[model samples]
Target chain A: DVKVTQSSRYLVKRTGEKVFLECVQDMDHENMFWYRQDPGLGLRLIYFSYDVKMKEKGDIPEGYSVSREKKERFSLILESASTNQTSMYLCAREVGANYGYTFGSGTRLTVV
Target chain B: DQQVKQNSPSLSVQEGRISILNCDYTNSMFDYFLWYKKYPAEGPTFLISISSIKDKNEDGRFTVFLNKSAKHLSLHIVPSQPGDSAVYFCAATDQTGANNLFFGTGTRLTVIP
Candidate 1:
């Protein structure tokens, strides 16, 4: 079955460390997104890629960057992790204009 | 500023009753609306969606209603079950079709037996 998979279910990192959250989709979707879910903030889009090597910043792109070198893989990088950045990171794939998203299980990253 | 908003932070409903979640958006350009359900420690899942042309869309026991004139939309869960309890997020996208969605703060629904 087609799915979006995250490399880690949970991660713990110290402050000032660089963290990478990986996502891969087998559906061959042209659009992939990264979001951070907080208690009251909901899902804030961090970044998205509409095609390979093409990326766009979302509402909350600060302290974060993305790499989409391949069609199936999208990686979210936190250059320097901080306690305030601790949140659940989600990856989603959109197939054309379907208007629905297939989301990964998510990675819960905790910065100490 | 937040383009989409869910005023209520939480809602409680009895099992077998209807649960209604409301969402409002300021962007008139948004033409597609969707609702998502999420449980703890898991990613949110797409529940239902409605286009701007239509007023309502139903799938199984879930239904979504859109009011373009009012810039509002709602999700109704009939005979809400315990398993249906989760955080529901409302999202919208405009005509650009770039797959960019603006999401609300989300409402946590609890079904009491």
Candidate 2:
């Protein structure tokens, strides 16, 4: 089975603080995604990387950025964290075009 | 605008009964549909999936039914158990392009013993 690991299981940051959420996949899947899970909003894609040094913005990418310097690791960056950014963040890797994504355990962020 | 929607926010079912979770999509271009189950403090896990060419797909106790005309899909879990309680989300994707999935809000299912 594919294992997607998040660097932090829980994080708390003050307003205006910079936040970094890291994700690493054991498998060699090319597609990696970041999503925020909010009540009543489901999982909204923040950003995705299809390859090393390549990235694309998703539906909701306003206050977030991503880095995929290497194939095995993908990171999400919040230049200035805010209360609204307090939500569960998930990392997922696409097994294939026609298959389901394998997700990490998730990181619960609390920006106060 | 939300392309996929799960109207019901929560559903309660008695143990040993049937639980049905419904989902609808506004995008007709979506050809692949998937269902995921999420427990508290964990990411969603893949449950089952169906393609546009088929109307029904089943795996053990979980079954998914799709209606192309209405752009609706449903998951049926027979003989519900307490362990089955979780938030269920339905996602759809158009395979023609990037295949990015649009997910529904999700329905929280609680099974009473």
Candidate 3:
């Protein structure tokens, strides 16, 4: 089974502080993605990396950045965290032949 | 603009009955649609998917139906079990990026025994 693990299950950050969410996958998938799930807004893509050190903006990538320093690890960075940025952040990895992605348990972030 | 829409916020069905979750997309470029199930405090898991050329795809008790002209897709779970209760998300991808998917707001499904 494909397993995606997140570094933190819950987080609390101060407003205007920078935040980093880490994710790792054991499936050796080439594509990694970061998404924030909000009530009534669903899951919006923030950033995705198809290859190591290569990142692309998704439909909603503002105020967020991502890093893929290694094949198994992907990180989501909040440039300047705000109360509005507090939400459930999810990390996912996708296999080449299939569109189904394996997602992490998710990190619930609260910015006050 | 919301490209994918799951109008239903929640749905309830009795155990052993069937649950149908619907989704629609405004973008014509989207060719692949997928359904994912999520439990509380957990990430969404891939349930099933259907391609544009195919109208229906079934895996076990789960089936996905796609309507091309209408730009709509629906996921049906037969003999709904209590364990199936969760939030289901509808997602789609276009030719431009096979890996980039747009998701719907999702529908919370409840199965009562």
Candidate 4:
């Protein structure tokens, strides 16, 4: 079975602070994604990495950026944490098109 | 504008019953549909999927149906168990799929014992 792990299961950050959420996948998938889920809004993509050092913006990439320094690791960085940025962050990896994604446990970020 | 929609925000079902979660999409170009189930504090996991060419796909107790004309698809869970309680999300991809997915507002399912 494929495993996707996130650095933290819960996080709290002060306003204007920088926040980083890390994800790593055991499988050698080519595609990695970052998503934030909110109540009433569901999961919205923040960013996705197709390869090491390669990234693409998702529909809701504002205020967020991502880095892929290694094939197994992807990181989400928030330049300035805001209350609105608090949400459940998820990481996923996929091998190819139309294939189902393997997801990390998730990080619940709270910005106060 | 949200391309995918799940009208029902929450659903409750009795154990040993059938639970149906519905999803609708506005884009006609979407050719692949998938269902994901997420537990509290966990990421969404792939449940089942159906291709546009076929209307129905099944995996044990979980089955997914697609209606191209209606641009609607649904997930049916038979003999629902308490373990099935979770948030069900409907997702789609255009012909190419390439890892980008449009997801619907998830439906929280509660299976009563």
| Predicted structure with the largest TM-score when compared to the true one | 2
lDDT of 1 by residue, B4-103 (tens): 9999999999999999999999999888898999999898888889999999999999999998999999999998999999999999888475646888
- Please give the range of 10 consecutive residues that has the lowest summed lDDT in model 1 chain B: B93-102
Q: Write the per-residue lDDT of candidate 1 for residues A1-112, one digit (tens) a residue.
A: 5689999999999999999999999977788999999998899899999999999999899999999999999999999999999999999998544457889999999999
Residue A43's C-alpha lDDT in candidate 2? 92
Q: Give interface RMSD, per candidate.
A: 1.6, 1.5, 1.9, 1.7
Error of 1 at A45 (Å): 0.9
Candidate 1 i-RMS: 1.6
Each candidate's B-chain TM-score, in sequence, is 0.96, 0.97, 0.96, 0.96
Task: Rank the candidate models, highest TM-score first.
Answer: 2, 1, 4, 3
Which pairs, if any, clash in model 4? none
Which candidate has the top score in lDDT?
A: 2
TM-score-best of 1 and 3: 1
Better of 2 and 3 by lDDT: 2
Off by over 4 Å in 1: none
In model 1, pairs of residues that clash are: none
Inter-residue clash pairs, candidate 2: none
Return the TM-score for candidate 2, rounded to 2 decimals: 0.97
TM-score of each: 0.96, 0.97, 0.93, 0.95
Model 4's CAPRI class is: medium
Worst 10 residues of 4 chain B by lDDT: B93-102
Displacement of residue A98 (Cα, Å) in model 4 is 5.0
Top DockQ: which candidate number?
A: 2
CAPRI-style quality class for the chain A–B interface of candidate 3: medium
Candidate 2 global CA lDDT score: 0.93
Taking chain A of model 1 alone, its TM-score versus the true chain A equals 0.95
lDDT of each: 0.92, 0.93, 0.90, 0.92
